[model samples]
Target: MGRKLQRIVEAAIIERIGPVTAQDLMAMSDDSWGLIRDQITDRRNGKDGLVARCLACECEVYIRTSKTRGIARPLFQHYNGSDPDCPWFQGRNIKPDAARAAQYQGKQESNFHRLMCELVGELAALDSRYIKHTVGQYRSPTENEHGRYPDTYVEWDDFGPFVVEFQMSGTFQTEISARCKHYEREGIPLLWILFGLDTATALPQSFIDVIRRHRGNAFVLDQAAVAASREQKTLVLSCYLRKPDGRLDAPKLVRFDALTVPRSKIPYHEDRIVGSRLAEIEKVRRPWFNALAQWEDRYKPLRDLARPQSLLLAAAFSIVAATNGKGRNYASEHSNISAMLNTYLSTKVLSPYSDLLKQIIENTRSSSIIKASVHDHLRRYRDAIQATNESPEWILLRKLLPEALDPVLREELAYLDALPDWANPTSE
Candidate 1:
């Protein structure tokens, strides 16, 4: 008799978010789970991916879909070849290559997959801007070490190169990630078009992964899209946008240029991930900003919220306001930011937050605030402040002003070239 399939993994410890059980995985919103899933896939592809380890043996784990009574749910599973010694080990996973071989029985690409590539290439050539297009051509990157052979490669006169990979079968996460990163670094936009999406009883995990990478967009090249592409003189796709309710919205024919091409080059119609997160962060800080903006004299409006834990926020915002040319002092009755900071430091009110304040000033465009006079003032209060990097204020500031205070978030935004002008540190 065949050995019993390994029991399902129960839980995983995500790097930044802590513990996530199978139930938690299923309960999370689509975007949330998608972010975690994409990070796991990225990690598997050898990028600086999210670290999620099995709760049982501390082995790295990835999220996989499990169907119960026709309803699909996500569950944690150890990667292939995980330690059999672990209680949660599901035995060795069938290698992706071995599974593909068994499914195709020897063929690499399905006949339909090839036909879809040819059709996409033909449709891509409908646009007047199209220069050339190839099917399954080897492409060497201008910068990266390895090269890739995209399913369909299209070039435009002014728009440059674009890649279209047709997803027809189960694809390994590593394969998905490598292609995504390779094209992104090569300055080429990549689009993954799904086949048999309309006929699938339940969408496969591979299809779901591609949709998530596209920020909940699922593209297809149906007859409608083909006709639309020809009429519009541009590559058009039938785009099904995944709603927050975990269901696909009505499919719409969207032009290729209509899609938002982020720095990662994964084209999506809606920014379901980053845009939502930044909006949530902004929502939390909106009230404080409003209150600070209307500051008249130091009264209950400011004092009521100014506990020791929150005083740093007030002072920091005051400095930020000054830098933005507002000249508002929400923290103190002083006329200017330098005077307000000097008063707080001399009185030992903001002394404990000296390190955090210095970091904020140095990293903002307001570095000029640290003049010779201010340096002398800081030296006088140095003994009292006992400035150290381990300030608790950093915790508060990192969340409020992440662009300037949080190194990780700053680096991420910088990479995307999306960092706001006000948050730029190098500006004089």
Candidate 2:
């Protein structure tokens, strides 16, 4: 909002993270909306935090923090369109009235990071080779004139060593330079998660350029979309994308590979759906919901826990909505907790807490906890599906709308069709 902040966010984009061009960096962040939204539906009942991994270097780091705390770090969040270089990334400049929306986003992201941290922890706890962390900050330096703090220092493993500071967005020129100096002078392997949240706002490539300007071990984390650093690497794309025709042509596949070119590119873009898929989604909701409803009845009766009771009720409604009053499951049915979790895990968005889930199942005292968790997660799927009236699974389902009598029925009809017909709901 202020000139000082503008400059800092801009400078940090390029200084701390490299490979992103100045145009990209400048196009990144935008004006703040109102307060961010904080109400998160944490189906996982998991902790919140940030996860960073380097496949090239075979290193990983995880840190947890509250939503508000998470938002304060000045990374590239949704775009209010401070930079007009890109219009595709930004839906519209909604920040003027987005305080509430932003607040919700911040909170949701907090939950997201929390679960991610949990997954990372579970991963590291599983394998000693991985460096999982519960990053706790003892002291945070005062904000500079632009309200940016120096590279964050967290309380890590040893009493006084190996804590990480994530230069989230707008690369930190000073921080990177200082990091290089620190490396030369103190040899600290500063683990930086050069990340961005591209919604309406995408970070400018300039941010990474700034980071590169700094001479240090500050290897740039792969930006989303631009591919996974040649090959055999890890990347954090906002939401995975496929071809417009849903026909992964060879060149498109090659282009997709190119998107992951060197470690220096982040071409994160919104997913573009192709043809009659949306119509097909509406077509399938009925049967899919029917199966889901049947399963909920079967599963809820067996749940036998207070936590699960609430979840069961919510899921029942969702299934009812999808069944649309039913008949089939689809291949893309993701309206279940396990399904959604599978989606994220399969896509490499979040590491799976599969082991943790198994652990919860085994924990003698936490059976109710596990049951409730499973139920709650499934309920979230139902609720999201119902609220949007998108389709059977509401998530993957999509189609063109037909003329309808009223908004309510229209919504339900649309949603019913969204259910995938071949998910084989009986499997899990």
Candidate 3:
């Protein structure tokens, strides 16, 4: 048999508010349950406090906290007795899976979930285009073929239904794949909401896998934002996206009233705009780009090199190359390039001509090009400069070099300049 009925209860509660393991409850404060008290009550003196109303039977219920002897953590219990048909009512013959069929079956929803659901429904109702659409908890038919009950189902005017699943527990890859297939077969688009944590922390592998299945890198909803939305009586969702390199882009607050119903199954298309804005902001604020700009600003007078715009170009090229020409992998590539460039700047010999060659090497390495490939460019540039002293490209490159090593550095910068606009730092 499974562990015990208590284990199921603990799993149910943890599934509602997680990123915290069952063992971590000892560290949780009393206020962790503060948000859920209005729905759940303490069963003291057999009748002192108000009881939670069962979702299925409307019977009174009470929650047991960690203070209860023998109980591990907080769990809901029927005050009088649970209805026979209620999912939370644990019958002597009930199977483990049957007892835990639905995540919120026996328990009252946390305030966060209830408030968010209300706000989301209100926002959907406010849309003029979808004013006629119905938004509420989707109760799958008792004989439902798929056995799927989405947290919130939205019926659009012209588009298909959108199913929102609020994920608070660890999700397995197999489960995610199965759900994706099930929803696709049912002709419903699915949206996942990740609750309780900031994206700066490493996401659960299950959460990441689910997002991947949805063709998204991340789907986050900040609890604080949801609470604020409840207070403002407006729907505001804090969306945090994970880039390809595994860093979260800046969080974007999307107003529910401003959401547009897409022709496709997926409703929200704001991630692309949010990602583009983040990229624009990162162009100037990226650590590697900032480092390059600072280095150029300090050393540009040493040699008559191009302005800091060249460094920006180089930074962009590095990001593009690192992401396999996608140009959107700045988050991880920025750190990688910054480390490599810092090492080169600190250790390399500093003649103006050599510095330019070093910068090119830094760019190549940042792009993840093999050392042998870089050496080929180095050899070709040296050979061509030696063969033709008055080559136009070589003459132009020599102007950027120090007078001391005019002939020594040899048109390497010229070779770099001859490449496409993306490769040349000075080309913009």
Name the best candidate (by lDDT). Answer: 1
lDDT string for model 3 (100-178, tens) is 5554442434433554454455555544445333334444643457556566666656554566666655546666666
> What are the C-alpha RMSDs, in order, of all predicted structures?
15.1, 25.7, 14.6
lDDT (CA) per prediction? 0.74, 0.30, 0.45
When summed lDDT is taken over every stretch of 10 residues in candidate 1, the lowest stretch is: 100-109
Candidate 2 lDDT at 150 equals: 20
Error of 2 at 26 (Å): 24
State which candidate, 1 or 3, has the greater TM-score. Answer: 1
Candidate 2: stretches off by over 4 Å: 1-98, 101-132, 139-164, 175-185, 197-206, 210-428
Predictions ranked by lDDT, top down?
Answer: 1, 3, 2
| Per-residue C-alpha lDDT of model 1 across residues 191-265, encoded as one tens digit per residue | 998865743256788888888788779998765676687788788888998876656787889999889898779
Each model's TM-score, in the order given?
0.62, 0.23, 0.37
Q: What's the CA RMSD of model 1 in angstroms?
A: 15.1
